[model samples]
Target: MNRPHYILQPVSPLFITLSLTGAFMLNLLPWGRWIGAPDFVALVLVFWGIHQPRKVGIGIAFFMGLMMDVHDSTLLGENALAYTMLSYLAIMIHRRVLWFPVMTQAVHVFPLLVFTQAIQVLVRFIVSGRFPGWLHFIESFVAIALWPAITWLLLAPQRRAVDRDHTRPI
Candidate 1:
């Protein structure tokens, strides 16, 4: 794939730090299986995958998952593999995905997270012969419901990005 001028674009130091920190916090949020929700890291990966694929892709996902593994103490490779695969798929579909409206994107986003989580489930099953119960779907559901809000929150800084770009007169 042809690369965009992203490196030349010069993203904000604040946004980079905040987005990664937010991903970590979201992953750390405590929740039960009461309602189905999508994986927050997966959601963030998709968000960045579509909006800032160059800045956050497989490398980010792999490393983030590794961090998560270190904290969660699950199989080291399990989350890493799931995150990398999900990031790859999000980028592969990024172009086509950007065309959809936020609500429509959420519709598909639900399944995307499901697919990612399914990979995790499959891995767990093969490795341990068991998977998290029905409760885990709550993560995907919550991810879809929050998609619009999350996108806006993250992308809200974008208008400022243009302002930031124009200030220095490149």
Candidate 2:
């Protein structure tokens, strides 16, 4: 059986870095006691990790997490540890996850996101001996809900522009 061909576009490292920076900035925004504000930085990290695993891997995630740690003024290594784990998981499942439609991908991603959040919370509890408000856990679901949109936005630049001239092979 024959398979359809697809045109793949190259992604820039600078673009990926900029995207991660934007997400970090979004996280720093004051959402004012919102329970499900969504962890923008983590979401972006996971996206890049899954789509561009070669370029965006555990080291990048760890650094991003450190920046988040400092930005949030929380424990030093908490976010770093969580992001490291998230990136590892993202890379491991990247191929399988990317093969699915966006909605289906989100369903696959929710558990991973939740796992990262659970790690973060576990670290926080270990450091401070207390759990955050129950609603804090809802943020992972919020991120899950926004996955399709986020994937579209981040992948938009990397999508190949189709050529109408059918004579040439892609």
Candidate 3:
């Protein structure tokens, strides 16, 4: 079955802010320390970075990372560094990634998410000399699984209606 191609409307900056804030709130929930807990912020960051690189680029990602760092009480620049790198990489390949189907985009995203997690783990390991175990990487896989749903949700606001009413001027 073929999917309908949408001519997406221009994304509102307010919607982007709200979505990022919502992701941050989700990250603040108590389940964050669980073995496979997905990183909502990271997911949202990647989404915006890929879809709206001009509006949500490395600076925004770095800011979000600093917020995460403060929340997690880890090293000051750990998440900032990771997210900055993630955003940079995402922006670098945003055009290429956007050409693929959602599933293929998720495949492309998986490595980016893994790389972010790896950076964090590497930082922590250097600081504390301890490994958090292989399960730490599961979070990236979980995030990848949510990619399609997230894409649908985030893009919903920008998608033009499938049934256009000819009488009305948009």
Better of 2 and 3 by lDDT: 3
- The candidate that wins on TM-score is 3
Q: Pick by lDDT: which candidate is best? A: 3
Candidate 2 TM-score to native: 0.90
Model 1 ranges off by over 4 Å: 1-13, 32-38, 161-170
Q: Quick one: ranking by TM-score, best first? A: 3, 2, 1
TM-score of each: 0.81, 0.90, 0.94
lDDT of candidate 1? Answer: 0.77
Q: Which stretches of candidate 2 lie over 4 Å from their true place?
A: 1-6, 162-170
Number of colliding residue pairs in each model: 11, 0, 0
In order, what is each prediction's RMSD in angstroms? 5.7, 2.7, 2.4
> Per-model C-alpha lDDT, please?
0.77, 0.87, 0.95
lDDT tens per residue, model 2, 26-115? 988898248888999889988988899999999999999999889888899889999999999999999999888888889888888899
Candidate 1 C-alpha lDDT tens digits along 2-45 = 42322234457578668877878866777522466346777888
Model 1 residue-pair collision total: 11
TM-score of 1: 0.81
**In candidate 3, which residue pairs clash?**
none
